[model samples]
Target: MSRQLAVMMVLLAASGLAQAVTKCQNGSETLYTSASCPAGYRNVTGSMRSHVMTVPGVAKNQEADRAMSALRMQAAAQNQADEEMDLRAQNAFWNQCLVIDYRVRATERAMQTTEYWSYADRYREHADALRALQYGMGCLG
Candidate 1:
């Protein structure tokens, strides 16, 4: 029984030694052997152990990055839409100003050509009111 136990112990130690490996790197090339690395090769066994370690938060961080990117894109699109609406409103306002200016000029011409005093006074009042509106809107500039 002692002889058998001794044999088993020797076999286990030999197996453990056989399982030990040395990892070596030369530039981009890598080698794994049960012996020591050759000259000109760097031992990378410690680095190999570090590479197997699990780093926490890597997946969660990637998900958060994607969420932030999506939010930024949504904000940019909304801003563009708001700008387009503002531009359309400005165009409509300018069109209204142009029509009002034309009416004011026509009223002044009528006041100059009319012979009836009351008609001329009415035209004058209408023109003044249109000019006041234009000034209030900053359209006169």
Candidate 2:
């Protein structure tokens, strides 16, 4: 029992001799040492100790990453919406061009089949106007 007590005492004394570490920072550089910080370096050992020991600047970096991700997602959504709107506008323009082309074809047919030269001339003028509108609207291109 006496030997056991001596061993326990030695163990306790050894545990109590555990070295303390100090963290120091100078500008953007960091260092750890068993002694106090050197000149031009600030002691940051107290701030470095916490329940979880979260590193400094990590939390801020994570927040910035989340903000950047949100902005990228918003920009992608806006681009998709703009592309969809442009497609819809193009579809509408093509539909209108098809209707105008049909009208011009019907007028040409009428001009060819009519016996009255005056009616034929009117039909020709109407077809020419429709063609002009189609070209002006970029449908011919």
Q: TM-score, each model?
A: 0.57, 0.61
Q: List ranges where model 1 is wrong by over 4 Å.
A: 1-54
How accurate locally is residue 40 in candidate 1, as Cα lDDT from 0 to 100?
90
After aligning candidate 1 to the native by TM-score, how far in Å is the CA of 46 from where it should be?
A: 17
Runs in model 2 lying further than 4 Å from the true structure:
1-56
Model 1 vs truth, CA RMSD: 15.6
lDDT scores in order = 0.77, 0.78
Model 1, 1-141: lDDT tens digits are 635643643464454423345678999887765568999999897876432222233456668889999999999999999999999999999998999999999999999999999999999999999999999988987
Number of the top candidate by TM-score? Answer: 2
**Candidate 2 lDDT, tens digit per residue, 1-141?**
635643643454355432345678999887765577999999987776332122234446678989999999999999999999999999999999999999999999999999999999999999999999999998997
